[model samples]
Target: MRHFWCILLAIAILPGFCQALDIKGVHYLSLQEVAGKLGMKTRWIQQDKTMQLESAWTKISFEVNKRDMTLNGTRIFMGYPIVASRGRFYLSESDYDHNIKPILTPQLSGAPPGLRHIVLDPGHGGKDPGAENKSIGLKEKALTLDLANRVKSKLQARGFRVTVTRGNDTFVSLENRAQNANRLNADLFISLHFNASSTTSVSGVETYAFTPNLQPSTSRSSLHSSDRKTYPGNARDEWNTLAAYYVQRSLFTSLKARDRGLKRARFTVLRDIRMPGILVEGGFVTNNTEGRNIGSASYRDKLATAIVDGILVYKKTLDRLAK
Candidate 1:
């Protein structure tokens, strides 16, 4: 009977075998069923139009009609909004399989992959200056390269091998960046960049993983035909989420910056990468206050330190799971 129950539990999580409802042409699973499978308890807050799934180690909160969700206090954007039907909330099957399940049950996905070799991509070089604040004499390309070097120093000091995509201020194509990492057999890839906005008031840190197959990116409100296509990075969806979560959490907490949430995008640098990869928007260079801060060497050092701290935390998680 014990073995029978274990078999049943295993069967419950299989996408093909699990029960689902067709909602607006998409398959969805009830929050109740999700909670049961994950050994969590569900609490519905009618007043707030929110539902929470809580366990000893994790707390996941979802709001009706919103793609934003929180996991263990860190913000993450779901591919689809939660829907209410018959007083019960449902999560899209795509998000359940690609986002929620991978994050909550990382161990079940597979053994943690090798994390010693890291590839750091400093966004925009040579001719491409990326985002810039002319008034503050700040350039995104120069800052990213400096930050990459600082992070490389810290990571190397910790005994991990690190590689930078471009060692100088020379242009490197997006395709070449991913291909270089693949050729070097890098375990992890991080693309570093500073952001700009027409509204200079916008300033925060954002981390992005490759958008999962069949799921809309965080930037998109609806799924597109291209969302159905799977990329090489999709193979590491679980690891990508885990890595991006840790890095984004660290950046937000350490820098006390606005929490922009963990997002997903089908960026060329991440789409074809063969390893767990993420792109980091360190901060906005357009903001008056933030632009000046970014121009200073100390703040860039702090950014590098925070990023390395996140990498360390991620490595520790893998180490613990391996044990």
Candidate 2:
């Protein structure tokens, strides 16, 4: 019986399509059917118009004839609006699959339990210079350290106990950085770095969480992809995924930077962290314009503030869930 329902849910969750499509080419499912089928308790708040669903961990509110839905208080934009017909409200396929599914069943990135201590990792130092653009005199190692320091201060101001892997222009192995977070019992880990590419024109910010088990990474290369292995990092894949989303969203939205999309990678620093962790490539150092922006102290401050803001947003969501 469970297997049968699993197959049903699978059918309902296909990308760009919901459980069933009407003759009108609109894909949708009954609000009650979706909630009952998914084992979520549902109620109508406005006698018939507003529908609410709650699971053990998530709460979602929707309205008939409305294009917006609130998942745990976060407004989600849907491709199709809810409509009333045959005395039932039908939810759009895109909303159910993309916006609703991720929050309700966050297989990609689970929400964190709480936010307390955060470890900021500044990538590359000492003998290693990390990424650099000699044309602009910007070195990744230095920029990361600076960004980490500023982020640490901002996080501290927000009452989060913050620590950095490298506080100065010194060397710290990737292994040690992860170990340090485990040692401190940090709740979150964020590694900071600026990117470099041969193509100087390309520039943007992308964040990475550890590759989930059995899933190919976003940048999976036939040459470098490895057999699926569950590391300590994969244990917190949920938190890692959510944290990466927060970081990427916060940075790009506040700084008006390019969106490079969230990614999955198996960097040693992220692979071994016991807590939810992510690495952020802030921007392209090889780009003439962006490289200059990254080199600016004020710009680094903005980036740092945005990172902190993102963590706060992530924390706020978890805090609401706990309540």
The top-ranked prediction according to TM-score is 1
lDDT of 2 by residue, 192-300 (tens): 9999899888998888878765444555532233534678997876677667777777887788887776676789999999888989999999998999999999999
Q: Give the TM-score comparing model 2 with the true structure, all chains together.
A: 0.70
Model 1 misplacement above 4 A: 1-20, 46-48
In Å, residue 152's CA in model 1 sits off its true spot by: 0.2
Give per-model TM-scores.
0.91, 0.70
By summed lDDT, the worst window of 10 consecutive residues in model 2 runs over 14-23
Angstrom error at residue 312, model 2: 0.5
Clashes of 1: 0
Cα lDDT of model 1 by residue, 1-323, tens digit: 43354347556774333334575578888787889889999997554499999999999999999998898888899898988754667898888887777778877878898899999999999999999899888899999999999999999999999999999999999999999999999999999999899998999999999999888899899889999998999999999998999999999898889888999999999998999999999999999887888888898899999999999988988898898
